[model samples]
Target: MSATRRQMLARTGAAGAGIAFTGAISELFAGTAAAHGRAGYGPLVPDPKGLLDLPKGFRYQVLSREGENLRSGEGKVPSNHDGMAAFGGKRGGVHLVRNHENRVTAKIGVPTVKGLTYDPAAKGGCTALALDRRNNVIGERVAIAGTAVNCAGGPTPWNTWLTCEETEDKAGTNGYTKDHGFIFEVDPVDPHRTGAEPLTAMGRFQHEAVAVDPRRGVVYETEDAFQKPFGLFYRFLPKKPQGGRGSLRAGGRLQAMRVPGIPDLSSIQEIGASFDGVEWVDVPDPLAVRTPIRHQDFGPKGVTHAQKLEGCYWGGSSVYFVSSFARKAEGSAGDHYGQIWRYDPSRRRLTLVIVFGPSTDIQLPGESPDNICLAPAGGLMVCEDGGGVQHVYGVTRRGDVYAMARNRQNIGTPDNPEWGEFAGAAFSPDHDTMYVNCYAPGTTFAVTGPWHR
Candidate 1:
């Protein structure tokens, strides 16, 4: 998904994927608010390492580097590391599940396992890295294979990853024998030995990410489709996801979000738009072999649609998701940088939490939030995949945004941005270290500092 995840957001002289980057270009250290507004994590000090620039007193360690051979000896390190999450492990160690969003090609691809292969011809899947307390990788291997476009997935309290497929490829295409676009579970402890079976009950679409409500076992999904057809926000009510390994495999009701007052949530121009309770109407045929799931099912129920639903994570009793960019041409009244919304299940209300304005330049802190993860320091952290110098932004508990880290790696790239789009920015369970991905020449960094508690 190099084109879908990174190039799509940064493409300006192009259109078609998601939002195009027609804005002016500027240097990373030139803009005021664009470079970084305030000292939320203290001012970013240029790094001597030349890989990443962090704030004063903060430093980063490389956990995994692309181009290195895989631990499983399956293939070289996978690129386009998109969505990821951290889990607790032995004696302060952590188990990190990373997603490789590579497309199908013959020679180069992500590693695949025999029994767990979904599409032998496909290359997209995920890997699990075992890191010790000091934040050093102890093990790394292909966790899930045969899936297509493993963009992002949520970690379950049951200690598993629900890796998602961002492509809607069918069987017999590109040498594929199985229909793609479904979620699969991977065990963090035994990622290489987990099940690759698609959670078919949870509709098949161009899925981006998922947020699991640990308390209810309900899985909320975000679709990364275009506005012409519009993407649908869905939830899966697993019949037996009562914190078990094969729980979601039981299959349950799949439904789309229907806001009672807002017919099309994307059309609302307001920043802090609010909507009373949402309805979840059943999606009769989620397999979507013939009819697209959003059109035939969601359209009939008048389910509210968003521009391009991307990152989704469960935190603070709410499922926070990203709607990358909305424009008037796409039926929305006005064009905005992007929006982040929080859906509170208990209150049964959805609140717009964050929104980005038009970028002054295609540079470092440009908006269009993609993958999101909770900072160990009590706030939300978003990976910027929009045009400009990509970064991983931090959102305070009080709603203040700050530039946490800048993509200062791969200094010799031909790309104007120079740095790769940030992905998989997640913190360890111990709250001592946070991990991030530099997309293309895939690199994973473990950053630690005096994080705000």
Candidate 2:
């Protein structure tokens, strides 16, 4: 049996996943207005190390960094750290499974362990980190190796990590010996349990992140294709639902979402707007051997498409997903900095819960909201991936957005300081710590402070 939906969300600190906490989309904008004042910890204080800035009384420690030697001595830490998940370990410790969104050209890649390597020629995979109660790194090693573009993924109901490949690159195209673009299950506590095999039945495409429905044992997926064609929202029904580790490998049926008259989600701008009688359409070819899943035919009614569909998570009995941003110049139906949508399985309905901006103001609180997780304190913690200063923002249940942390790391010269987008923001089961990733000059951080409860 699987964990109940509330138990899963509670474990993940996703109880606040419903963006419209007050039950009104209008409250989101009102909260935005209230954001002018402070909603979270007062303001961020600069870090002397120039790595990360947090509010007073809060501190961050670098748990892992690119090119650093791994504790296992298998190899150095890989580059392009992306999505991650935290699980409770023995004696008040925490275990994290992190993804490396590397390609063939990366200088340091996940080492090819004998049984863990999926394709020696490929340079993307996942790594596991073991930390004690004090947030000290106790053990670290490659969880899965030899994949490609391992991007954002989700945690399972039975204590496992699902790592996704964000590329459609084929075996021979870029020195990859095996076909890329599939989800792989990684056990945080035991590396050997991974088996390093892709779940091919979930469909082939540029997958971003996933959210598992513990109640129904369903997996909701998001695609992050850059341009014109965009991407589709997907759900996979496993043959053996919630059978614990490695059960997804058994097989599954893949399907895309359809919203009746709405061909593109970007076209819907009104807040709180929703569509009923939402349906799922079967993909003619889940493998995408002949045509990509989104490009495949779904008849005249067509299927719903969204630009830059990224972060996904399950909470409040609904599947919450994000559209990082869309631009009209790039062939989208409309333009917006960010959007958060919720699909309620019980109601068979989809609603637009949060809308960021159509404005170009870099200082806006909601600019290009990427990886998101509901905070244990009853709000959403959003990672800003837009231009200008990079920040980890906090959005309250009432919709107020505030800066919680800032990337002060300057990887470049004073004339041009480079800051990477934050990804994989998740909280511990005890709600005492939060873990996130810095995409460039890859670094993993464990943040601790006085959080609202």
Candidate 3:
């Protein structure tokens, strides 16, 4: 490794020691390296030649493409697809709910919803597709009414998908008079006829994803803001008892996490420390209900920020979060390395699971680990959000890394390209099939594996 990278590893090791121990650091490095080396032997699938690489015996077919005519005959194809969730309907068909993370791009087509155009220049939105057992599209519907930059979100236990808008604006001209960031719930089967009002009770922030604890009605949320000193991490507790569902706007208690033991390193030393655990602080009223301007009160010490926290999931009795743009040393340009953190609600503890960056021994060249999905066999599938040679990677709980699929056919310019990999990674209810979405080409894929690993 390079000298700079070695130094980075040393610093990361020290941080890891502070969080857990040096032994954990060694295991993290060794496990990831070992996993990458053994990737080719784990599972074999017959992947498409020259399109992307996969294990032997795995095959994929196109499910939906941008601008393709659906049951509604809406238009050609949608663009900037991101997070997705799959639900099995009573009719034995699977319903895939997807997010379109479109920015201010005019080339991508927008949904035809009246008074629901959040941004005139916004191209991406959210859609739900009903697929038969054979993975064919039975129907399609646009769920959320008006929103922009719809990023990665999680599925609720109540059988509803939470779609998050990842934009925070000072000037609210983008069809969002209330706030730029919020979460919306949509029924996968009936997307077009969604409720008129949004679930505003789920605090307003630059939301990236939401993970709900099935036992507790507590919802964990991640933020993707960095323009300020610290980005915020939040948890919402519904006021009503468990098993109650209607709209997120009904009522809930919003609270921000505060790492008290670890000082605010950015302000004091111009560098943040790599601490492992976090403490929670309740924020009674995020948006002052009494005021018409909708001002947010972040409490006294304010919110503690981390690297750009993008994707999150609830697993192993803890919530896992990924920092896409983690700093290498104290003061360095954001590196490609990302770190996965596990937050245990039972113990109220935060643990640093693994760190990914060029500085570390194991490196992933991707810019951001946008969205993540767990495998029934015990591992994670991450969506790459960098440029050139994008792919979908599988990582084990033991820190093993493998490149499961690549987007060779989806390589082109940012806009108006043949294929560009995005997010929306979901597994079928039976865990027998995998589904993925491409943003540049605006398409979805259904793949079947031979299961003889």
Candidate achieving the largest lDDT? 2
| Tens digits of per-residue lDDT for model 2, 1-453 | 111111111112335433444474332233222322336776678788888989898888899999999999998999998899999999999999999999999878899998998999999999999999999999999999999999899999999999999998887888888888899999999979777888999989999999999989999999999866899999999999866888898998899999999989989865568899999999899988878888899988989999999999987578899998888899899877788888998999999877764333454345788888867666678888888668788876555566788887766778977788888899888878999999888999999987742
- Residue 12 of candidate 1: its Cα lDDT? 32
Q: How would you encode candidate 1's per-residue C-alpha lDDT over 333-439 as one tens digit per residue? A: 44667777778888787866556644655654646888887665554578888865777877543344567788776645465436678888887876678888888
Which ranges in model 2 have alpha carbons more than 4 Å from their true place?
A: 1-21, 24-38, 358-365
Q: What is the TM-score (0 to 1) of candidate 1?
A: 0.87
The candidate scoring highest on TM-score is 2
Ranking by TM-score: 2, 1, 3
Consecutive 10-residue window with the lowest summed lDDT within model 3? 2-11
Worst 10 residues of 2 by lDDT: 1-10
- Pairs clashing in candidate 2? none
Candidate 3 residue-wise lDDT, 335-448, digit = tens: 435666667787776655555534222223334577888654555677877655566776543444556777766455557444466588888887778888876667788877
Model 1 misplaced regions, further than 4 Å: 1-38, 297-301, 330-333, 410-417
- For each candidate, give its TM-score against the true structure: 0.87, 0.92, 0.80
Pick by lDDT: 1 or 3, better one:
1
Q: In order, what is each prediction's RMSD in angstroms?
A: 7.9, 6.9, 5.9
| 77: Cα error in model 2, Å | 0.7
Cand. 3 Cα-lDDT: 0.63
- Candidate 3 Cα RMSD (Å): 5.9
